[model samples]
Target: MKKNINITEEDRKIAAFAALAIVIHVLESSFPSPFPGIKPGLANIITLLVLFRYGWRFAAWVSLLRVTAGSLLLGTFMSPTFFLSLSGALASLLAMLLLWSSIRPWVGMAGISILASISHVMAQLLVAWWLFIPHRGILALTPILIATGIFFGLFNAIIASSIEKRLTDTV
Candidate 1:
């Protein structure tokens, strides 16, 4: 049975953005990190830009697609690493949704990005502790994870904002 599936312009836009994010994700994954779970998460800049430009829904599509497709490309699909990434992405999306719905008028990009980053780290930590580690030591990484999250969150937001500005200027 052949059925025609209509694809909208919006879907194409989402796929293009998702592809860019996935490339960044793969490149970031190739880099060596001082800590096991620490990365710059440069791919998130795409999500942030999409969120501010389009909306939370578009951003969520980009983020989730990046995580899933990136994992497949990295051969980590269905692995512990995949689960961690999925959990972090889901948590970040949830945080973005909440902020977008509530205090979006008051919050700026940095604030939203920081909160999302912190939530992502926390979710990954909890999932690690619950599913794999099951040790108190995993929780000990909380402070450092949070610190990096804030730093990277702010960093990504700045980059996103710059990109957004350039995009607006061109358009």
Candidate 2:
């Protein structure tokens, strides 16, 4: 017998969030960065918001969808960029899951966002070093990347929090 899976309205909501994330990702990609690997990661704001509002599952769906669809849309599917994006999303998801599951009551959006952001950057850096560069020089960028992650993570968390407040007010 074939097992049936039920799709609910929540699935549609998650898909909508994922689409928004993908759009944001693509738009962010259009801008030129003065340096490589210095993106603000604003698209992650949607994921962080969804995680705070819905749950980790919804947030994971949105984040992974954004990375996969965004990579495909950018014509980077199965390329180095795709791998890096996937690694970062997966790492961030893992970090968020751990933090949200254990210390959720104690920690807030800023804490989770900062940890996830650092995890994402670390994963991407490791992937880049292992797959592309394969040199000790890759380690030199760790401090800079981590600092950027912290800054952007806080910034994105603030944006997400503001959006959430507005949404709650309307509802």
Compare the candidates by lDDT and give the number of the best one: 1
Summing lDDT over every window of 10 consecutive residues in candidate 1, give the lowest-scoring window.
162-171
What ranges in model 2 sit over 4 Å off? 1-6, 169-171
Off by over 4 Å in 1: 169-171
What tens-digit string does per-residue lDDT give for candidate 2 at 1-171? 999888888888888889999999999999999879899999999999999989999999999999988998999999999999999999999999999999899998899999999999999999999999999999899999999999999999999999998885222
| Superposition error at 52 for model 1 (Å) | 0.7
lDDT of each: 0.95, 0.93
Clashes of 1: 0
TM-score of model 1 vs. true structure? 0.97
Give candidate 2's error at residue 72 in angstroms. Answer: 1.2
The prediction achieving the highest TM-score against the true structure is 1
